[model samples]
Target chain A: MSNFSVAFRTTGSVTILALNGELDAHTAPELESAIQHCKNEGAYNIIVSGAQLDYISSAGLGVFMAFIEEFRTLGGDIKIAALQPKVFNVFDLLGFPLIFSIAETEEAAVEMFSKGTTHN
Target chain B: MTATIHTLAIPSATRYLKDVRRFILRHARKAQLPDDAIEALQLAVDEACTNIIEHAYGGSTKHKVDIAIIVDPTRVMVRIRDRGQPFDQQSYIAPNVVALTRQGQAGGLGVHIIRKLMDQVEYLSEGRTNEIRLTKYRTH
Candidate 1:
């Protein structure tokens, strides 16, 4: 089976990507493309909700690491929320917990963005 | 409860690893692992297969890549063999992720992640083939 199914929805300046299924080497690019579109649309903040996400790979992590700087350059940052333990562990292993603003719920993520970016 | 061994030879490309992914997922579901377990299996397998596609081939010109996945009821063993240049896994260790940039391979995360996810992992370097074996146990 292919790794992941991606859905995108935009609200004002925030773009939320809801990832379903697996996020591994093969499907990481699809998410990257979606993020690039967010940048193209001038969306400053990108929130990826992984509440339904099943897994992630190093390639998946690479996509997030590779795009963060570009998003920051565009005056925005990426936040992750509701990541499953198995998936979240991969991000933590890469030390992404320190780099990305992660929240326990999507509401918390939106609240975080509403509160402004202070994790810098 | 039976062992199924399948060997595949295909061109070396990131695209081709999809076949490996599909192969594993089919049996993974048949093995009835929790969704998280299956995903972990996929990650470990990708890390190993990608190492073959990148380090073993080092170039897209590699005509064929060899892969063997063994699925047993108690455990899943993936052995990927390639004829690419030789390297030492033991001599390689990942730099601390906290203080490292994504440049210069960002070393050992692959191997370290494998170790964390899988129950056992080993590399066999001999003759013209480099074999990386990763095994994960199945727990209800």
Candidate 2:
């Protein structure tokens, strides 16, 4: 299997990215590129669905931190949902809950963007 | 379980991190650690290798990082040895995650994750080599 792959689509005004496989240092740049693609297309409100993400490292987490400011400044936010426990623990351990909107389902994440609320 | 040790050396590059993680996971699973513990070990090892590649080697792929996995009945230990720049473990300050997030910083979180996941982390320098040992005890 490929170490990582990203599928992009749009739902309403939100850009939904479905990430599969592992996200580490090597594959992080692919995700960065995907996020940049969204930005170039004028997508600010983004939802990353991690239902297929098997693992993530600090380098992977850094990608989100890198783009969050730009996204939020454009009146949009990056929200994550459907993370496996293994992947979610990494974010939770780093206290990402305080900084990012994380939901249990992709629909909920898109809903949060639509309502313009940070609450997960 | 009988005591066993396995070692691997790879270029200090981010691209090789996947192979490094796979090597550790395969051995960690054979050692029969819990799934969560194996995941934690993989993350911790990846962070350590990344530090060596980025900070120690200055993102140079010419150098090498050596890894050794020591499996015993009660614990699994990972030793990562690098010949890149010497690291000063004593002067290291753990990243303040809250402040980092506030400032929108993307770096400085790798070391913190390593410290949190490993049961014991020891860094030492011997002449030109820098070694980091990470250990996780069996839960059962």
TM-score of each model, in listed order? 0.79, 0.95
Q: Which residue runs of candidate 1 sit more than 4 Å off their true CA positions?
A: A1-6, B1-4, B28-37, B59-62, B71-75, B101-108, B137-140
| Reference-based lDDT, residue A75, model 1 | 76
How good is the docking of model 1, as DockQ? 0.32
- lDDT, candidate 1, residue A27? 79
Off by over 4 Å in 2: none
Judge candidate 1 against the unseen true structure and give its global Cα lDDT, from 0 to 1.
0.75
Model 2 RMSD in angstroms: 1.6
Candidate 1 lDDT score at position A98: 81
Per model, the share of native interface contacts recovered reads 0.24, 0.63
- Clash pairs (backbone) in predicted model 1: none
lDDT of 2 by residue, B1-140 (tens): 58899999998888888899899999999888998899999999999999999999999899999999999988999999999887777788998776775567787888889999989999988999999999999886
Q: Which ten residues in a row have the lowest lDDT in candidate 2 chain A?
A: A111-120
Worst 10 residues of 1 chain A by lDDT: A65-74
Q: Which candidate is the best by TM-score?
A: 2
Docking class of 2: medium
